[model samples]
Target: MKSGSGLKDRLVAQARAEGFVDCRICRPWDVPQVPARLEAFLRAGYHGQMEWMAERTHWRGDPAKLWPEARSVIMLAESYTPEGDPTGILAHPDRGAISVYARNKDYHDLVKKRLKRLARWLIAEAGGEVKVFVDTAPVPEKALGHAAGLGWQGKHTNLVSRDWGNWAFLGSVFSTLELPADDVEVDHCGSCRACLDACPTDAFPAPYQLDARRCISYLTIEHKGPVEEELRGKLGNRIYGCDDCLAACPWNKFAVAASDMRYAARDDLNAPVLAELAALDDAAFRAKFSGSPIKRIGRDRFVRNVLYAIGNSGLTTLVPVAQALTDDPDPTVADAARWAAEQLS
Candidate 1:
């Protein structure tokens, strides 16, 4: 027999009590009619340099094969809504707009800690084992979240919760205990193409599908080398990730303030001076971004991005800064700086 308690309510209450902004439960199964949907997404090469996305097509969309023993999936969301609209920073060309996710220390560490504790509690109460996932997993977490009624997948393709807006970082807690599934929420994006029109690079070719090849987030944070020359200026001062699509959603009005303190904006990260970031040596870069997710990009690539921003800044004052990186050991950094110096000169 299943546990006497109503597992859904108990888990939801437990989630809130554990400081998760919201939680929802869903059955572990194949995404009905999503194989071709995914095949189309891959066929269009929407995943870009994220080769792993296409490599594990089988285990990604279905949770059952990921862990055959899993009976229920608990999808939890943590909000990182900013104190103010981040879009305002775009006008300040000299300042690089770091994506809100990297504004604080990494969420993967913070959310995983909370998820493990929550999973432990569930196992203790229900007398079973559990597994936890935070972003890096074979499971289609956003799809599972949608199935669990956590939110609908917006046109931007990121899960958008009615309560948290599009400012959520997702984590999953898979368990062996059987839990009643919640009603899956239907898409609320009906007739609203705000996100589709708002993207600077127009990353989305169609509704609910993202061609990550053109996504600024993928370009700055994921892609390596001399980011497409034509797309360089279009990147503006958004040195990290782009959020124009997420910010344009009308549903974001319902968002509450950030629930995780780590997700809160750091004064230093909110709008970093491109000139200052461009000057960071490896030691200085590590010292400054230690424990922050931005550190993962390293000084060379990070500086390369800053050089591109400085070029777009059109601020002649940053010319000397770009010229200084002219002879740097890293070819990418040097090329970016040279390009920026030429443009800014």
Candidate 2:
């Protein structure tokens, strides 16, 4: 127990040195509420087309089930808070509003690199097997994060740190070492419904729950095929993940800007013209967003999102661009283009 106590502090120190904004530990079984909450989310079909969420339900809802050998779950956060208002570009309908996180390099690569560094150090220090994961895993990161005292899950269902707000990316390191666990963070959301009210698509069925099928981020980045026509106009100019709920958080007043310049929004991505993004072919899209998280969505889905933005822009001049894409090779992009051109007409 004495060695366990010492190792916990060392791990936290190492994580901070690796540029993690915050780090905390919890036992694998700390998140008891996850099973019921996740089951309810799945039963309600809130995961939308993310079928992977259902495939690993047992492991996702119970960290103990994920790897029985894991004794400690270390949850870390790295801030990506934008220097300016993330939602400011939404008003400029002619420009795309890529989520602040996606405007820079892909966080999976950046955060995983830091997590691996910490994991390697942990193995050397405590001689325990470790596995690191970013958002790619089915791990209930936010639930474990709340249990680890990093933050409480806010009304938006995203982890909200009193110190770092919701503008942070989460990563986890599962270790066989039995480290001392931190006290859990209780809900600090109180009466604030700012995040709930800020949803442009009404994605939240209630506070603390989200219907991803109706979410702009899911539509633009994850959902394939034609977007539900009714929701396209509400997408406004957001061409990637949406940040409305995170930007609406009142807790941001206490948030600090990210220390890593890798998260700084790129000038080109900050306010890319709708017509320009709408014109990117597969190769051009790849070249433009090679290292960006947005590249994962591919040109077809991305152009579909851009068409939605162009349709919502109310700029008749962009009608021709939308009309030109009406015959795009990708059926979804063509569907979106026809809808956009029709919206303008």
Give the top-scoring candidate (lDDT). 2
- The lDDT per prediction is 0.86, 0.91
lDDT of 2 by residue, 150-245 (tens): 999999999998898888999999988888889999899999999999999999999999999999889888898988888998999998989999
Per-candidate TM equals: 0.97, 0.98
How many pairs of residues collide in each model? 0, 0
lDDT of 1: 0.86
Show model 1 residue runs off by greater than 4 Å.
Answer: none
lDDT of 1 by residue, 25-137 (tens): 88788356556778888898888788888877778867787888988888999888878888999999999998888888998898999899899888777877789999888
- Superposed by TM-score, candidate 1 places the C-alpha of residue 39 at a distance from the truth, in angstroms, of 2.1
